[model samples]
Target: MDRFEVLSVFFGHKTAASVVAAHSHPYWQLEIVTHGGLRCAFAGDGFALEAGDMLLVPPECEHGFVYDKPGVSWITIRFERAEDGESRWGGVIRGRPFTDRLVSSFKIAIPGSADKPYEKAFVGGFLDALLHYIRSDEFRQPADSPGALLGQITDMVLARGGRAVTVSELAEELSYTRSHLSKKFRAIAGESLKAYIDRLRVQKAEELLKYREDSISEIAADLGFGDLFSFSRFVKKHTGASPRELKGK
Candidate 1:
């Protein structure tokens, strides 16, 4: 019943402002732009990633981005070492040769590779390899049991994005106290549970704004916002773009 691994695939359009803004994450991120272009800054060094290009950014690297078009889609995998293990990664651990190999081997394009059935199936293979590698003693030491809690909590969030989520609710589901989950969620996700929830809600809302024809008010209500004004404020705070502007782009 313990979920300690993370494997995910995201395929859809995205905006420039959605990708930009310097931020650091606590887990590894591997991404490939299928059709559009993306510019990312990793640890002060920047590179423009385009169609067919692959990127492997280690954890804790300060990165920001700008996308060329609205049809930006990619896959990302986030994972961590076992608890009490020394394989703790932060602020950009140098990627291993195996990491580079896995990145190069993954195909994230939609209508995927012509030969692949789905982008998920293609990129999912690399994620599978990464998990196997991370579990190996040569790649990372065994971590303690307490550390696995964060991965479990994050898995829940990703599986059910902002769906009736709350600290207390998570605690009850995971059989942990609220305070413990809060602290570990922050430590592992690089943000508080509430913060991650807000980010997830906003990100989901952004996707809807880009792809759906819903009006601002409708979008707001659909995303569980109290009202248009509140949703507008939330979108502005995170992405620095109004709903209209985001939709238009």
Candidate 2:
């Protein structure tokens, strides 16, 4: 079955300063800071995560944190992808629907919530609810900070599948001028607007090549490339590998 299965769940309490070295895993993980604070680094970018904040780390992404604040408590849910929903993005999650879900999940977990061994099914249910929420337009919670804006941008790209979009289009969709939008994106993400989109495209293309049974040309067109050559060039330029090589065929 292509559904997410909980591998392990734990509620953590830290009383002293600690550092978790960067590491990667083949499965997905969710971390919610229920109390105190933590500085988490994903892909070398540091996000000061506090209470009422959450993080969903995707497969194979290197992440770690410095828990310097005593009395910090968190819930870590490690799960594997038996389900095929790649529409989700990883990063700092805060405010609105996401936070609301975090609180509820913990509330249930604390009092025999599914984050435990005997009640792992509860975690799966929570994940299903989350996936459903993410697939809906209602998931576009208001962004009160740059971090929220970054999540919005990531969601926008994932929502696009493999298609291409311009900065002006993104700005227009977000109701901001091209320059202003790009500046904020760069400041928060530490990457140029175009680079981020292109990188996202490359990631999508790589995923399709590896998993989906789409032909090279078809994948190229799906990503909005004018031709197979252009798509091949893009994949090569960014990843130093051709689609065939990536596909291992």
Candidate 3:
């Protein structure tokens, strides 16, 4: 089975003076606070997370924060969902309640120096183990729960292969009114449906640019962009790179 792909990982420290403005990313983020505390604002809500607290911020959520105390330290892993929709983390993590055990498990899995020869494999295994613990009986939910619905919607968006999808279309297929679906989605997923779709499309474009020999124009058309210029703007907005630059990377 495919698993979540770790795009980057690092340990960071912040002083009381540190501040980050509202920003969003196109990859899932797992952050574990190991020292001091942080004040985070997301989805119009605020949270004070301290030592042993773990926060999972889904893609496209507008979040910002500041250190609440001196010497705030944390471990962050940015990851992308598997193209095959088989990532264990994706299904287990959406709207799931955090637990002390889960926090401890993540702390234990923290990676060593990035310079280590086995760093990548070690971090990947660590994430797999952490997800394993989270998927245990204590954290698992019924198939009909809100978390499951969120997971289902995520899978559908990913499976579209960058095809444009609207909230109304998804709601109609799910037998829900658009307004109700939008509210519930934001409440559970921590981001708007449109933002999620945009990020997913850019992610798909990145994959195609890296792995396929198709011309940029072909990719733009395939992703439903009106023209190359439109696709260029969309990619730059989300990824901060043009098609040529991304392909070079």
Best candidate per lDDT, number? 2
Write model 2 residue lDDT over 44-102, tens digit each, in one string.
79999888788889899999999999999988889986646455477876645455655
Q: Tens-digit lDDT track for model 1 on 72-189?
A: 7755455443354345332222244345445546542433232234544445455557546555553443223444555455556655543437889889997879998788777766
**If the candidates were sorted by their lDDT against the true structure, best first, what order would they fall in?**
2, 3, 1
Give residue 222's lDDT in candidate 3 (0 to 100): 90
Residue pairs clashing, model 2: 2-82, 2-83, 3-82, 3-83, 109-113
Best by TM-score: 2
Q: What's the distance in Å from true for residue 246, model 1?
A: 1.3
Q: Report lDDT (CA) for all predictions.
A: 0.62, 0.80, 0.74
Q: What's the C-alpha lDDT at position 245 in model 2?
A: 98
Assess candidate 1 and give its TM-score to the true structure.
0.41
Across 1-249, the per-residue lDDT of candidate 3 in tens digits comes to 336667777788876567788788988777777788888777667788877666667688777887858899988878775555444233213232234444455456554433444665556666666666565653475657887687667667876789889999889988899999999989988899889889888999999988889999999999988999999999999999999899888
Give the poorly placed runs of model 1, Cα more than 4 Å off. Answer: 1-148, 162-164
Clashes of each: 4, 5, 0
Candidate 3 RMSD to the correct structure: 18.2
